[model samples]
Target: MSDESNQTEGPIAGISDVPVTLTVSVGRARPTVGELLSLTADDIFTLDKSLDDPVDLYVGDHLVGRGVLEELDEPGSGRLGIRITEIAPIKDLV
Candidate 1:
């Protein structure tokens, strides 16, 4: 088959720039009622994931990618950000 025949159209060209929500999951924890109620300002709750593990990214509820968490330092701008490590296949997003 010719190259042109093998190539199918991709997603609608105009919608690529649309905004979407991307989530990064560090981990999950189940807290008991007593634990939840006893929480204070200095309390720290541990998550299931470790520092070296990659975080999962989600749009709405569907997973779209995975990335690593990073901290940024630029004078007054101290924010946490994600550096996408791997993106899910196009088929998977659909």
Candidate 2:
């Protein structure tokens, strides 16, 4: 077979269009079962991380990246976004 025939059109051609769910872990709270069940409206559940901590980005159980939480500044969008600070190696991701 010719080399051209074996070459892919582009890097990640087959999987580039694949849709994957990316999860952003802002923080975690370890509330007791009683505390969780007894929660009422307007309750403030505290997280283990502070506002300045970097959030973790995960694809399935594997950690893919880390980023800081940000609020989008588009007029009235008010959407929450993440600013990627660190990324796991490609080998680690797969």
Candidate 3:
């Protein structure tokens, strides 16, 4: 009954394979540095959120969940996925 009592009864048992970086905040645009140096390559800048907005899932700035932006046709893996919906309360993700 020891290994330090099973690692103190698992308070995230030894970092739980530590690795954290989940940030998918899909909207934010404050273009001005002369509209970000007058970009020209199919230029389009307008985002404060629109397109059925609900995408914000961070692990650093801590907003921890909310999603709905998905497009993964799966033929050639045209990636982009997130469909969580809402989940920010484990004491607001610490």
Q: Candidate 2 at 63: error in angstroms?
A: 0.5
Model 1, range 1-94, lDDT digits (tens) per residue?
3455555457644465568877778899888999999999998889999998999999888888899978778755769888899998888876
Output the TM-score of candidate 1. 0.72
lDDT by residue (5-69, candidate 2, tens digit) is: 65445455466446899999989998999998899999998998999999999999999999998
Off by over 4 Å in 1: 1-12, 73-77
Highest lDDT model number: 2
For each candidate in turn, the TM-score is: 0.72, 0.78, 0.29
Alpha-carbon RMSD, each predicted model: 6.1, 5.7, 12.6
- Write the residue-wise lDDT of candidate 3 on 1-94 in tens digits: 3456445233455664568999888799988898778798999988999988998999899898898988788656778789898888665554
For residue 20, model 1's alpha carbon misses the true position, in angstroms, by: 1.0
What is the descending lDDT order?
A: 2, 1, 3
Pairs with backbone N, CA or C atoms under 3 Å apart (clashes), candidate 2: none
Off by over 4 Å in 2: 1-13, 74-77
Predictions in order: lDDT: 0.82, 0.86, 0.79
